[model samples]
Target: DHTHLKKALVFTNSRTDAEETILEMRRMAAKRGERDVFHVHHGSISAMLREETEAALRQGPGPAVAAATLTLELGIDLGELERVLQLGAPYSCASFVQRLGRSGRRGDAASEMIFVTPEEEDEEAQLPARMPWTLLRAIAVIELYVREKWVEPLNVRQLPVGLLYHQTMSILKSMGEAEPEDLKEAVLSLPSFRGIDPADYDAFMEYMIGMGHIETMEEGTVLIGLAGEKIVNNFRFYAVFKDDEEHVVYNGTEEIGSITTVPPPGYCFTLAGKLWKIEEVDTRHKAVYVKSSRGKVDTLWLGAGGDVHTRIMAKIREVLGSTALYPYLAPSAAARLERARRLAKESGLLTSEVLPAGGDSMFILPWAGSRQFRTLERLLKNNLKGRLGLRSIVPMEPYYMVVAGRTDAETLQEEIIA
Candidate 1:
C-alpha cells in the first residue's frame, strides 16, 4: 500500500478546497481506525498552526500529510517529503515545477508528483460537458514545460501605487524624521520606484501631506503623522493588499483561526482540517467560540482564480483537436478523452467554427485565447447586438460565444469581419 511514503504534501488551488480535502482525508483515516494525520495550511489559517504542521511533517513519528494552497508553494523547508500530490491542473508550468520539486528530496532520488483530477460523467450531458477540460489543461501544461521548456512569461506591474505608499510610510517610520529632499531621494532610489518621475513623486508626497499621513516641521523635515503611525504599527501592515475584517475563532482556550463572517450560534464549520461547532458569537469583540464538531458542514469562502495565458489556452485547443495519445493518462482518463474526441468529431466542431444551436441560436468558436475571446464577447454585446436583432448572448470565455438572434451566419460573419 506504499506505506513507505510516510510524509506527503497535497496542493490545492484555494483555501476552501484545501480544507475540504483534509476533512475528507480525516474521515477516511477515522474509518480505518488510524490516527488523524492530516493538516491544513493556508493564508487564512493562523501562522502558529501552519508552523506547527510544518514541524510535525519534519519530525513527527507517524505518517503526516498537509493540504495547502499557495502558502506552501513558496520555499519552506519541511525536511524530505516522500510524495507530492496535486488536486487538479496547476495554474502554470512554473507552479507545476515548484510543487514537483518538493518531493523525493533524499539522496539522488528524483522528484515526482501525482495529479488527481476528477471528472464528472453524465449520460444526458452536452458535448461541452463531456470534454475533459482539466485533463487537457494538465496535458498542455506538462507538454509545454517538458517538450518546449517554456513557462509563462512574467509581466511586471506597470503601476504599483499601493506598494509605493507602503514603502514611503515604512521608510519614514524607520527614519523618525527626514528632510523633504532626503525623503524623496530615499524612496525613489529603490529599484521598484525607478520608473517613477520626480514630479510624480512630488505629487504623491503632496497628496500624503494633504491627507495628514505625514507632517512637516518648521525645520523643513517630514515625519510620520498620527494617521500614518496608526497604519504602520498594525500587524497586518506588512501585507500589501487590504484584508477583510475577520472574527477570530477559539476552541475553548486554544486559538483556531480567523474568518470574514460569523454565523449565529449552532452553525458548524471546518477550519484547520477539523470541524468546529459554533457555541457563542461575541459580535462586540469579534470572537467566535467553538467546540469540536463531527457533523458535516458546507462552508463558503472568497478566493480569486488564476489567470490563464493565451498560449496555454491555444495548447488546450490543440490537445482537443489532435489525436495524439498522452501516456500519462490513466485508463479511465484515456477512455474519457476518446469519448470526447468522438463526440467532438461527430458534432462538426473539428471543421466548422460556427454551428447552429436549435432554431435561432448559434455558437461561434474562434479557437482563440482569453484576450481574443474578451474582444469578441464585447463586440457581440456592444457593437452588433441591435444590428443583429440579438435576443441574448452567452459567453463561455476562451472557448466559445453563444448568441441567439434573428441574424443568419452570413450576415453575422459579414458584421464580425467588418
Candidate 2:
C-alpha cells in the first residue's frame, strides 16, 4: 500500500471489538513490516491517548488506522479520511450510511467501504441475513439521495415521560428545591420534550406529589422527598431508562467495568470482543464482575423494539413489484429480496387489497413501514377495535397484519381508504 494512503478508520459497534480490531490490524501490519501504522480509539481508552491519535491522524501522510466505536461517528474533525472499514453490519440503515459518509474526503474518487461480516453459525446469525435486503436498502438510500436530495427528518415529537421522571429528581437533587411552574417550563423547553401537552405536564406533577415522589413546600418550591432522594442517590438512576439489575466487573482486586444487568450464571457474553465469565455479582452496586472466558452469547433486552416507517416498507414492496434490478445489490441481498417477492406473489399478497390471515381475522398489507403501522394500529385500536369486535392486532414486516375477532376486511379497508 502507498504511504500516502495511510490514514484509515475501522469502525466497530462495541468497545471491545474496537480494541481487538486495532490489535489485530497492528499484528497484520507487523507481518507486512508496517507495525506502527494503526491505532485504537474508543470510550474506554484514555482521553489523552484519544487526543494524541486524533492529532497524529490530522498530521496525515504516514499510514495510520484507528479502530473506533461510535465515538468517531460524529464530531472530532480529522479532516478527510482515505478509507473506511466497517467490521460488521450497523444496527440501523441510518447508522450504516453515516459511517459510509466518513471516508473519501479530500477529493478522492468516491468513498470506499468494506463491510466485513464475522463468521457465525447460529440461529441468531441468520437474523441479519434474513432481514430485508440491506444492499437494496443501501441502493435505495443512495437513489433517494440522488432523486430527491433529501434525508429523513429527525423525530423530535415523542413526549419524554421517562426523561421527565429522571430530570425532575435530578433538578430536585441538584438545586434542593424548584418552583413547580419553573420546573415544568424547564423540562418543556428541552427540544426532546416538545409537543408535550401542558395538561399532561400538570398531571405528571400531581402524580408525583400524590405518589410522594416529590414534596410541595409552603414556599412554592418542589423538594426532593424521601422517595426522590432514594432514587436520585443511586448511581443507576443517572441514566433515564429504569435499570432492572446491576453487574460489576472485578479484575482480581480492581474494578474495571460495571453493567446495569448481568447474564445468568454460566452464560457467556462478548464485551469489547473477548468472552467473559460472570464469576460474581454485587447487586447492591448493580454490577456483575466477570473474568475472561471462551465462547459467544447473544445480548437480549426487553422492549417493544424499533419502529419501521410505513413509507420504507412501501418502498420495499415497490422494489419487489418492479422488474428493475439494482446492479449494486450483493448476491445475498438480491436473493433475500427475490425470496420475499416470491412469498408475496405466492400468497397473492402483491395484488390483494385485503388479506385474510385465518378465520375470524384479517390482515391488510399496506406495504407501510413501522411508524405508519403504529399510527394506523393506534387509530384502529381506538376507533375500530371495540366496534369491530377486534380482539388483537399485530403487524409483521413487509406489510402483513394480524387482526383477530370478527373483523370485516371490507369495512376495515373502506375505513383505511376513506
Candidate 3:
C-alpha cells in the first residue's frame, strides 16, 4: 500500500510454501490494484525467469515482493531489500542470520526480519497438545544465540558410503577407466571422503562390481558397468543428493514449479497461491501443463520433516519449568506460552516421566533427542515385544514417546527400573 515498501523477500522452508506464498501475495496485491508485482524464485524455477525476478527487484519503481526458498539465502543481490520475512522459525541459527542480513542496506537504515509462526491448534482437549513447540523453539534458538552465540555446527559424516558409490562411478566414467589402486587414491584424495579407509573402499568396490555398478577390464582397471554408465551419462547425476522423481510444471510456455506427484486434469492444486488445473500431464516430457483456475488447494512437496536438536529440546523443557516471561513474545504468543506453561505443570511434562494417554496407551516423556527416542523404540519393539505385548512405540522427537498395547504404569516403571 505504501511506496516505501519497494522490495521485500519472504523466505519459506520449502519450495511448495514459496510458490504458495507467491500466489497468495499476488492475490492480495491484486486486490489493492497491484498486478504482476509478486514473483517466486526457487531452484526449480528456470534460470531466465529467476534472473528476470532479480532484474525486476533491482530496478523497481513501485513495490515488488519475492516469495522465495533457500535458493535466495546465499548472498544473492536482490536490490534495495527493505525487509525480510521468515514464514517459520528458521531451520538453524545460521539461516536465521543469513535471512536477516538481506535487508536495510540503505545508508544507516536498520535491517529487519519479522518471524511469523502459528501457535499449535487445540483439538479434543488433548493434554500437552497445546504446547507451542515451534514457538518455544524459535524463542530458545534466539535466546541461545543471544546468550551463548550457539550455532549448529556442520555435520559431516565420516563414511559417506552413498556418496562414495556415486563418486566412484563418476570418476571412472570421466577418466575413461582407472585401476583398483588408482581408484582408491583418487576417491581418498577428496577431502569429503578422506576419512574412508582403503580396506573399506576395497569392500565397497567388490560390492559395486558384484552389483554391476563397476566392471573390471583386461588390465585390472575398472570401467563403468552397464548400470553405472546409464546414471553418469545423465546431467542430473552430477549432484550428490538423491532427488525424488519430479514432474515439471508449466503454465502455457512458462514453468511455474515442479512436483514429485502428478495430479490429473481438473484435479485442483496450488502453486505460487491461486488455483491451477492440470491441463495436460506429459509423462514423456516429464512436464505438466497447467491453467489458472478458481479456488484454493493444499500443496505438498516430497521431503522429510527436520530433526530437532538436543539443545533446543533441553531449552523447551527449561521454558516449560520456568516462569520467566520473554519480552519478545506477541500478545497471542505470550498468552499461548502461559497456557502451555500451565498445561506442562498440570500434565507432569516437567515433573513426571510417565503420563497416561486416553486409550490403554501410556505416554513416556523422556525428553531425549531423536537417536535415544529411536533406540528406545527398537528396544521396546524387539526386546519387550512378547513380554510386554508392546503394540507400538512411537517416537515423537524432542517431546515424548507413546507406548501402547496392554501396558500399564507399573510395567513401564518396572521395565525402566530393571
- State which candidate has the highest lDDT: 1
Q: TM-score ranking from best to worst?
A: 3, 1, 2
Candidate 2: tens digits of C-alpha lDDT, residues 101-176: 7876777558667665543324342222233544434445455544556456677647767788887778667777
| TM-score of structure candidate 3 | 0.82
Model 1 regions more than 4 Å off = 1-5, 159-240, 350-354, 364-418
The per-model lDDT (C-alpha) reads 0.83, 0.65, 0.77
lDDT of 3 by residue, 1-418 (tens): 3222567778888877787777766777777785677777877777767887787777866477787887888767877776677887775677776777787778888877777887656756456556777788788777777677887777788998878888887788877878789878888899988888788889998998998979998888889899887888887888777767888888899877677888787787876545788989899999999898877676756654456666767777898889998887788988888888988888777887778786878778766665666776777778886788878887666577777878787678578657
Instruction: Give the per-residue Cα lDDT of candidate 3 at 158.
Output: 92
The lowest-lDDT stretch of 10 consecutive residues in candidate 3 is 1-10
Per-residue alpha-carbon lDDT of model 1 for 143-188, expressed as tens digits?
Answer: 8998899888887866579999999998988899999888889998
Candidate 1, run of 10 with poorest lDDT: 1-10
RMSD (Å) per prediction:
5.4, 6.6, 3.9
CA shift of 239, model 3, Å: 4.4
Better of 2 and 3 by lDDT: 3
User: What lDDT score goes with residue 138 in model 2?
Assistant: 46
